[model samples]
Target: MPEGHTIHRLAQDYAEAFAGTEVRVTSPQGKFSDAADLLTGGRLTRTDAHGKHLFLGFGPAGHPTPAESIPARPAAPGRAAPGPATAPAPAAQDHDDPDHDDTAPSGWVHIHLGLFGKVAFGPVPAPPPADTVRLRLVNDTAHVDLRGPTTCALITAPEKRAVHDRLGPDPLREDADPGAAHRRISRSRTTVAALLMDQKVIAGVGNVYRAEVLFRHGIDPYRPGRDITPAEWDALWSDLVDLMREGVRANRIDTVRPEHTPEAMGRPPRVDDHGGEVYVYRRAHLPCLLCGTPVRTAGLAARNLFWCPTCQQR
Candidate 1:
């Protein structure tokens, strides 16, 4: 599935294309038709993302908050195909976020793109939507399509808050509290790798970030969370912020430091579909970028974990 940065990038894309405007909401697939009907003429007043969850706020037509009006940035054209095959729709109970007002007048459309979900954008004269579209938003300037999302529901303000209340802190959000995540991590016997992948423990980290961040810090993936010192946790958290933020800006995960980039090292750019240079993460059996040790991989938390065994000594 797409990482937290991809979700945040989608939030920015949705805001730039349709937020604050009167949107034509529809569910061509008929699954979300009722909610779309209710939101059809409403203005997209706000857009938010926490971890992999996305929210598009709808309310009566009025002035939108300045915050929702982000300046457009150069992004990849058309579709964002970020994950693997389709899976079951997500349960709202899994991911956590901070609560919005429980008494607000507007409603939120929560979306979680499980593996195989995709999002696409286009100009105003959008072509006929495919029968698979779960949601579509149109305005004078652009149109966007959502397909195969794990969770797409029209939720009341309180319901949105409830979802957020259950989630751990999101590093991308200004409101995130690293200490909250540290508290949970410092007390757990679980491997730090598993803890980082747990949404309930730390929002928005996926296999890619979890593996790459650990490799970057030379941390053993098998290290228990309780064994992670506060200073190490702090450094890890701060690196996540920086790397994920760069991911948002570039719309891709490139975790390699400047000196390790292809240009700096006189090496060809990485040729993976994920489109990022990194020390580890899907580079199994390849030489480690730093120590020239063969990168290793194993199953952890149901996802592949990659690291440099020589560098990430326990």
Candidate 2:
């Protein structure tokens, strides 16, 4: 499944490419025909993201989202929307609302690409879409195609709010609050590894992040959330903020420290289907980066858990 970083980059890419322009929305596979009709010919007001969910709002092309319309409010309006765990800051405080334009009742199209979902973007006059294509959005200059997504539906404002209400905070957004996530984890007796994958506790964390972040913090994946100290939780959340940010900018998930990269370690780059360099994640039985201890793996929450026994011996 595409993680939060990938979703965030989609939000950024779509906003820059399609927002503020009228788009020809269509369902090449006919699965999203109704949803496409709702957005067809409407200007993409904004692109919003929450954890694994993506929301695209439709309205007049130039109708400034309260933030961009007013000159007195010197704030940038384009940012990821809040999820269930986050509430938008007061409109009076900042202009960064998630494309909450006051026009067009078509509202937002909520998209959740589970595991196989993919969106392909290219220059204007999009080429023939694949048979599995679910949705397509095109402007005069650029276009994007969606396929294999677990969800592609037209939703109302209230429905969007409801979706956000069910998710935990996302670290990629400026308004994300780690305190609430910490509180949720503090009360759970489940293993920290499993809890990290729970969207309700901390949105956007997946199997890869769960393994890499735990390994990065040197915390035993088997450790119960209740047994974790607040200080440890803080460090974990902080590291995610930093690492996930890099993932968004670089458009890939690279979780090794500067000293541990392939060049620094004088070793070959990672060889995995995921397309990134990771530490203990899929390196079971291999030598640990910091120590010679053999990395190990086990099944946890139906996902493979990886770690260095010596480094994360907690």
TM-score of every candidate relative to the true structure? 0.89, 0.88
The lDDT values for all models are 0.82, 0.78
Q: Give the TM-score comparing model 1 with the true structure, all chains together.
A: 0.89
Model 1: lDDT of residue 80: 44
Candidate 1, pairs of clashing residues: 96-167, 97-164
| lDDT by residue for model 1 (190-254), tens | 99999999999889999999999998898999999999999999999999988887788788899
**What shift in Å separates residue 161 of candidate 1 from its native position after superposition?**
0.8
**What does the lDDT come to for candidate 2?**
0.78
Structure candidate 2, residue pairs in collision: 84-164
Distance from true position, residue 312, model 2, in Å? 0.4
